[model samples]
Target chain A: MRIWHGLLIALGLGVAGGLYITAPAPLDAGFASDHTADTEAGALVFAAAGCASCHTAPDGASEGPQVLAGGHAFASDFGTFYAPNISPDPASGIGAWDLPTFARAVTKGVSPDGAHYYPAFPYASYQNMTDADVADLFAYMQTLPASAQPNQPHDVGFPFNIRRGLGLWKVAFMPDGYVTPAPDDPVLARGRYLAEGLAHCAECHTPRNAVGALLTDQWMAGAPNPSGKGRVPNITPAALDWSESDLIEYFTSGFTPDYDSAGGEMVEVIENLSQLPEADRAALAAYVAALPPIPSP
Target chain B: MKRIFGLSLATCALAAAAFAGSHANPALEGAVKARNAQMSVIAYHTGLLGGMAKGDVPYDAATAVAAAENLASAAAMKRAVLWIEGTEQGAVAGSRAKAEIWSDAAGFEEKAVALEAASSAMITAAGTDLDALRAAMADVGGSCGACHKAYRGPKN
Candidate 1:
């Protein structure tokens, strides 16, 4: 009996040791310290990243920057995730968070307290963003009006609610690089950055496996709408039959080639894209038009 | 014999009008067709004006005026009857209207009224100048968007 007790104690220690080694860690200090935060550039990055679409209140009735009170609920198979108040309010928002903490949260999907964030935040795509862009986004977020709304807790079921389990998910999914080979053309490169990095379009456009890992093999062939019931269309060159000009027009006006305007979550996406420069929209159109056509799953 | 033929043609015209007006509480299949036809009319006029607004087609003053008038007429049509109570997503396939339309009848009517107001403004401004047309276009788009976001389903 004593020998068995000793063996169980050894087994417990080994498990604990394995967990400690695999736990998600914050980025090393002094990493990306060279890129200075520019509030002006950050503003554009903030718009491209569509931070306000999720962070803003659901009704979003308020005009200007007052809408970032963050009560939007994203319902998924995992559970409903209430976007946290990202406003600059020191008490209830990220007002007190420093740049490094923000970077870690944005890229590594880890909170300042070392808790793992659910993939619902789309940090997997954001992980591809440049350090400069991340710094700029943090700087721009600081300039927004602070809201005192309290952060809402997620409504995940047990076992899944264990944030530590996400550390293993990060190991399987999280990485800092492009999903596909980098394009040689400058316009394509910019388009790739906007689609894959700041915009995180794949978070919705790409279908996921049973365990919720993205099916990278299919890429942007589209998936069931993450927010609800309908299927998001495949934007690969073969499936999306829009001309480059048609895409730019749709981005600018939200009208499809069929004259039907975009609805649902795409309404917000179009609203954000409309705020970008005409050139940026064109770049996006050009890049999307160039994508290798993948058959829809 | 000619008089009899004329009487039959007149009867057919009256019958068609009655069929169009009686679209309220239509059978499930008929409701989808009626609503889709109504939306198609709206889209047709919207496309004409949209083509001019985006400069995709030449901005002819006469064409702009005609399109704007057609749109206003379409918006003013008493077609709300076509949105039968049971003709939403689950009850009928291929219809993107949500059940919220019936549940929130007052809200839906308010949006319809907003569309009328926007279309009225477009009719007033469409032939005046390019700038006026552009401003009115924004209002029309916004009104359509307001209704769609609340009542329509995601595109398939």
Candidate 2:
């Protein structure tokens, strides 16, 4: 019996090792030598993701919460997960991460150390980022002055804390590669990238199932969050009353079609988006305006 | 240009009607009306900002300063007064707006205070040079978000 058990363990290890070896080789790419463009692109991504809102401490407060000095807590069904610092700090942040590792985390949900990240980081949407865009983003991040604050350990409980379980989740839900714009439909392709990559609209719009998995088929249809408090509204073109130009304007300036202001999380998104180049903001509006007016469930 | 336009009111009325039609709560209607009024002010300011951004209007320091002051005043209505405290928490559609804003009164007040503080700074800075204006705008913009991070409904 003992011999058989030992053989089973060895077989399992071999299979896991085999799977790792067969996986696609992480792509090798780098930002163009033009420092200016890379930095500009980086700023855009930062705004799109609203990185500063969560990462930074509130105003007049000492140093803005360590730039990338992640310690923000997100309460969810599985457990509480504290955000980790992604600054270029060698000791705490991703300072030592190679380009591919950063790409993998942003686009593939896998960290440089081979650990799986919780969806709170929104890599699912980020999976649509193009390689060139990711390269530029990586370079931009590298340029930020490093933050030395150490990471905050997640308060997640057992089972959820097991990194191996995330492997199963990834296999089931993770998109295999970045979204490529279809040649036939530039609008859709652009929308797909903006929605799926930069905006990560579904993170808040789509409802999660019992295990906290996103109900992808529902798409932007509204769903209740773990908070069990307020429900995220249905944002498919159908539910929204704003026109494309109006939506674009709102995103750029935070004004609703009725000229009433959007508050809360949207305000931050608007703030972040306001800083983006106008072209990108327009593209996002174009794509969102084109979504099927999916009815609320 | 402070003249009332009926389009927003019409839209809000339509939206209210669509939500529950004639039988809706008068209190909720009143609240929505108040919210709409404040939002209109924000919209008006946004229009001025648009003109400034496009260089359609001259970037006169005085007018720019006035526009910025209008923005600050418009933002000042006690946020708690605008939307009835608990109305958003019980919304039917899946909304990420938390009940915490009402339950944890102190925290909610803090968010409002933060927004107010930032808005004030923006008003002070708007009449300055373009670079200064942009930086102040960024701060003002960021203040609007800082509060939203904890309180507002998620972007659909």
Q: Top model by lDDT, which number? A: 1
C-alpha DockQ for predicted model 2 = 0.18
Q: Each model's DockQ?
A: 0.27, 0.18
lDDT for model 1 comes to: 0.81
Write down the worst ten-residue block by lDDT for model 2 chain A.
A57-66
Tens digits of per-residue lDDT, candidate 1, A19-98, equal: 98558786867767898789989888888899988999887663567457898998988889999999999888988888
Q: Give the TM-score of each candidate.
A: 0.81, 0.67
Indicate the residue-level lDDT of A176 in model 1. Answer: 50
Candidate by candidate, in order, the iRMS in Å equals 2.3, 4.7
Q: Which prediction has the highest TM-score against the true structure?
A: 1
Worst-scoring 10-residue span by lDDT in model 1 chain A: A59-68
Model 2 steric clash pairs: A57-A65, A230-B95, A231-B94, A231-B95, A232-B94, A232-B95, A260-B39, A264-B148, A264-B152
Chain A TM-scores of all predicted models: 0.93, 0.83
